[model samples]
Target: MSDDVVAPVATAAPATHEPPARDITDGGPDMVQFLDADGQPVALNEVNSPYAEYVDAIDDEQLRSLYRDLVLVRRVDAEGHALQRQGELGLWPSLLGQEAAQVGAGRAMRPQDYAFPGYREHGVAWCKGVDPINLLGMFRGVNHGGWDSNENNFHLYTIVIGNQMLHASGYAMGVQKDGMVGTGDPERDTAVMAFTGDGGTAQGDYNESLVFASVAHSPVVFFVQNNHWAISEPNDRQFTIPPYQRARGFGIPGVRVDGNDVLASLAVTQGALDRARSGGGPTLIEAFTYRMGAHTTSDDPTKYRIAAEVDIWKKKDPIDRLRKHLESKGLADQEWLEALDAEADELALRIRTACQQMPNPPHSEMFEKVYAEPHPLVEREREEFLAYQASFEEED
Candidate 1:
């Protein structure tokens, strides 16, 4: 509700007079990594980055939790995939290797935090208490959205490329107008995590969202899950440099992390959330992960991407890497991990059952929730549709 438009800032970090630089360092798709691909403890004693503190705080239980997160997140993802394959849904977007990125960031948010997620952010929706069955409803072509966003503090699944960015900025600005930012109360302070993919970075909305957030110093985090491939178009096609560096041009603090690494993802997101809550303004986090599966059930990766890349990414699978890391720390027991696997299987079955039970909605779906107030045309259409339904046989 605050209709304030802001001009762009050209600073890298928040400052008293002005920020120092407009360009931050680029690590050639390898910067901000706190964990290794081999699931080994490689990063230590780093002064160049402020995120070193959180990276050092990772414990065994937390590591196990991260492992469990991937297990469940992957299950939800696979369930969505099966729904599409079984013809229960129209199209399904896969977050195969980006589990850690989504779960970590989603977990980083406090209950008071609001999220504006892209279409494929079902992982985040799960974290926000959105039912898995509801997630399928959208792709099932049975509903526009699964649940009321206000109920869980999450916005609708935005399909238009980067449109959610503006919606998020607008929401964040409202939080500012309501005196929610810098309130000193953690619960009172509202931060937004706007999810987008690497491909959406080319969108003007994404760029403008950053501009508005930076100038207004809104409590927002632009979470870019850079899964490398934007459908068929690769990351290189979008920009010459990495997407994390794109944040600097908008005068904001930017960090890139090993997206598939749960610990790294959690650490970076937690830090960014903390910063935003403390009135440090918006930070852009580019989770450098891979989209191991096809963009969606509709497209085949075999057509455009090479198998060799898939094979390489498989070796760096998010679930496998986290499990290995947890095992190395003596946190993962065979019984526990096995039980977790069983739970995943049970969940898959439960969702499969739900898919079968999906009800066929009446043609009213064409305009049911399109408006809060009744329009004359919509009212007439809805009445006609109801009459048509009555023409069919019914129990009543």
Candidate 2:
């Protein structure tokens, strides 16, 4: 990644009377982290020991692939943000510093498992085989969702905050009833994963979904990418305690992982998904990461946050950490890394061209999907709309 694309850590602003927000840079002792900010491996301790086996089992090829994923996903975010700025897209929610949190959890899922994502899970969508162009259509105002949800076992991006949790819980209950859990068959057993943000934890739907999943013993994983700020609100405004620590109240096992550490994120999420698939019920995974960009293209972080905080997280960039690990371990060479960079350039161009070429949906399309069967009211509205459009054409 270029230095220009990465936001620089600025000097801290003059202190104010308001109390300073909690320093969440270090995810506390309980946070599972395999790779430190400098890309050095940390000594395995009781907190992270259980998840270490999963990371240890990863082959060299898999490690290189993880690096590739982190790079490509970041490129995707960069391109999307650029497109929004260039007016090709109406808006974009950047995954920025949260690449490892999304990709690690995303790669852990099997083909049969389903995912319910919030609007910003572009990294997860990429891992689930959705074309980057498909993701742009919604932002471009061309379609409600550009891909089939069932085709990839990835649901459409839910714009409503925390709503997918309820959807995922209900689907998990159905999967349980269908006898798809604990079948002793790897291919048949299925798990559901719901993605949300730190702010989502405050929503009533999020709590309700936990209740439903707990009572039903549903095979689901609630993956919360706690990126510190909930839009303009800091973590202090959202909760009294970290999300992972609060999961116990719901009778679900919760684990906090260093969201910037791809290996740790993958290992912890894999463990949780494995447990759920085996009918162990639901688990909550709090990926302790940071959002390096604005909440969306429409948001301006400078108005609400300090550049110092962004700089702290920037040192812990997921892509940089993985790249360092690959270099130090001899998993990827300079030539291969350069080629991957070239590949990212190609990907960016492809998506940019695709976005520019996307045709706007017909004006009449708004009325097309209102009902499965044609309704008299809808037909009348369509006729009126067409007449209105025709009147404009006559004047032109």
The root-mean-square deviation over C-alpha atoms between each candidate and the true structure, in angstroms, is 8.1, 6.0
lDDT of 1 by residue, 72-94 (tens): 87998988897788788888999
Off by over 4 Å in 2: 1-23
lDDT score at residue 263, model 1, on the 0-100 scale: 73
- The most accurate candidate by TM-score is 2
TM-score of each: 0.89, 0.94
Clashes of each: 0, 0
lDDT of 2 by residue, 197-245 (tens): 9999999999999999998999999999999878887776777667777
In model 2, the worst 10-residue window by lDDT is: 1-10
Task: Specify the highest-lDDT model's number.
Answer: 2
lDDT comparing candidate 2 with the true structure: 0.89
